[model samples]
Target: MISRIAETGHAVGTAVGYRNLSKKGQRTVKAGLLLSPVLLWLVLYKYLALGYNVYLSFSEMSYTGEFSFVGLANWQQLANDPVFFQSLFNTVVLFATIPVSIAIALGIAILLNQQFPGNNAFRSLFFLPYITMMVAIAVIWQYMFKTDGGVINYFLLQLGVIESNISWFGDSTWALVAIFAIQVWKTVGFYIVILLAGLQTIPEQVYQVAKIDGATRLQRFLYLTLPLLKSTIGVCMLVGIVISFRLFDLILVLTNGGPGNGTEILLTWIYKQAFLHGNFGYAAALSVVMIALAVVVALIGRNLQRSSHL
Candidate 1:
């Protein structure tokens, strides 16, 4: 009788364990089923597309959909292409806006962090440009930077900043400057908002303690604020780098890489090669280069962020 009872108890315990395991397996399957659609979409649209693009970089495709494996011909062409180097240089130059925008945004954010009348209104006003359509902003800026009767030129003339009207978009020298100015104006507001949030994360008691220690405002900002805000600044730098690289639409609407491709960056040049010039293989190679550069920059940024924390 004792042996029978023990056997019965063992059987019931095994059954309970099996039931629990079966339920766990079922839940796992359900979760996978729920996530399968999104996973499939990403596989098809992102990873597969990326792999195909890499393949295309090694192959040539004509305008009439004629495809042929060209091996490294496109890359060799890219190595000898002056326009590719020029676009690379131009893209590097666009990074100049990152530091300038960060400085301006940080300054504004600091000022706005203090208690002041109409502070929220000022923030909203500054952030207005960020919410506006990029193409619309580009169009408005194009008109403002017009050679004749533009608001900017008129103001410059009135203030004796320039002796004559300047062709902002038409001139190679000033076209890039115009692009930089518009980019900074459009992005600074967003940076300001981001920096403001970073600033708020810092406890007010820290500032009070600094003041008690006889620290001047500038000293406190330099020694206290900047050190604590390092991570936030790193985030801003990475964001700025990404934004600078994705400047195709703004450049397209503003200069169309005009003034004899003077303002041409990687994306604009890629668009021209693939769509206008029908050199899809070469364009794909350029894209690969751009992606590699972006990855390198992002990795560097990540390392820097990690080092700051250390």
Candidate 2:
């Protein structure tokens, strides 16, 4: 009887071990199946494309139909390039444009979040700019910023603010400011939608309670609304910073980095280096720098969120 009992115990252990192993294998298979598509896309696009770009960044490839390996030489040349510095300054100069847009968006979002009549209509109207073609916006904005007879200047003159039309898009000095104005106008609505969503997630009861306690609108906004919207604000700011750094199409359409590389940001600078100057490798290095800056901006935004909580 003792021998039979021992044999039964051994059989149970073996079966349990086999079952566990089978379950482990099944889980492994499932995980692989789930990740296969993502891995495939990574291999096909991100990994391979990134690898090629890195390789190209180390060489000299110009539109003049010449290609040569130059090691870190391109990076070295780019380091000493004046236009590169100008581009960096231009990129930084344009950074404020997006934040202003976000602020405007926040204001608009607050208005839309109110239980006023036609709230939906207001929200939709604000979002229209986001869907508008970048090229069209750029074109129309350029005409409005024209040196003479521009609508903005026309109104300013009529209002007696200025005796003459200011060269909005003409002078190199004021050109960046003009670009900022246009960028803000085109994107404020987009930010408003984002802020509106964030505002909606906040509970109505919180505001109601504040109101019940005699909190003024300004006080509630400062103490409760701003704190509650921290994460959303961070996300919007981070995205805005990243997008601002990468602004190319609109800049290209409006100023083409005009008046002498005054408005040329990183991407246009990259285009000039890679295509016009035939220095793909240097361009790649610049691209990496821009990417690193974006990552830094994201990190800063997260840090701000943490501090706001504290």
Candidate 3:
């Protein structure tokens, strides 16, 4: 009996040792595996692209394939460049419309949150514009806003409103207004969808409690909805601000910063500087400034989100 027991114990110990070695060997193999596509993407798409752009910003590389070391030339030119300053001013004007658009989006979100017929249909209708091609939207808007033969002007003309049609892209002041209006139209619906998601995440139980406590609609919105929606709304604002700053395709299709450059934005100006004028170094510097602005905007948005939560 003692001999049989000793033989069984030895067999069990051997099995345990084999199992331990197998696990370690498997782990070692896992650790030394070849690069996955995700790792390759991180190296090629992210790091390499970022490093190259940063390097290009400091060097003068014109279309002629010539390179020269120009330190601070582009950034220095950015300060004195009249059009760059104009573009910056245009960017500020563009951002001014964000609050108004967000306000409209909030109202839409609130309406969509209620239990009503065709609510999904209404939501889809609002969201459709966001997914539509920007080029198509820009073309259609420009036609609608045309100084003559435009549906908008035609309605006003039929009503005997004024002797002259408004030249939306003709004058500097009106040009910016036209761009701002288009931007708001394109962006508000997207933001509405975002706010709608945030609104729906809110608990029905909370609203029921608010009602039992004799809280008004406005009170609930102020005390509960708005406070709880800080994060979602902050993200939407960041997206809107970034889109406004980086607005390119729409500008390219619509006005092209034309009518004497009245509608020029920073990105449009950068395009002109880089491709049209072939000032690569200056354009790179402008690109750096834009990146810096983007960073600042992101930081400010995050800080505001934190403060709102507090």
1-310: candidate 3 lDDT, tens digit per residue: 9999999999999778657777777676556565466778899997887676677777789678788887777677778888888887887678776767888899999989888999999988888877788889888988998898988788878899867898877787877887778788778888998898888888889989999999999999999989988888778778877667535888778788876787788788888988998887777777776777766767766765786652
RMSD, one per candidate, in order = 6.4, 6.9, 8.0
After superposition, the stretches of candidate 1 with alpha carbons farther than 4 Å from their true spots are 1-39, 308-310
Whole-structure CA lDDT of model 2: 0.80
Query: Following a full C-alpha superposition, what root-mean-square deviation does model 2 have from the true structure?
Result: 6.9
Residue 175 local lDDT, model 1: 93
- What's the true lDDT of residue 163 in model 1? 96
Alpha-carbon runs more than 4 Å astray in model 3 = 1-44, 156-163, 304-310
TM-score of each candidate structure, all chains considered together? 0.85, 0.83, 0.80
Clashing pairs in 3: none
The lDDT for every candidate, in the order shown, is: 0.88, 0.80, 0.80
Q: What order do you get sorting by TM-score, best first?
A: 1, 2, 3
Candidate 1, residue 294: the lDDT equals 74
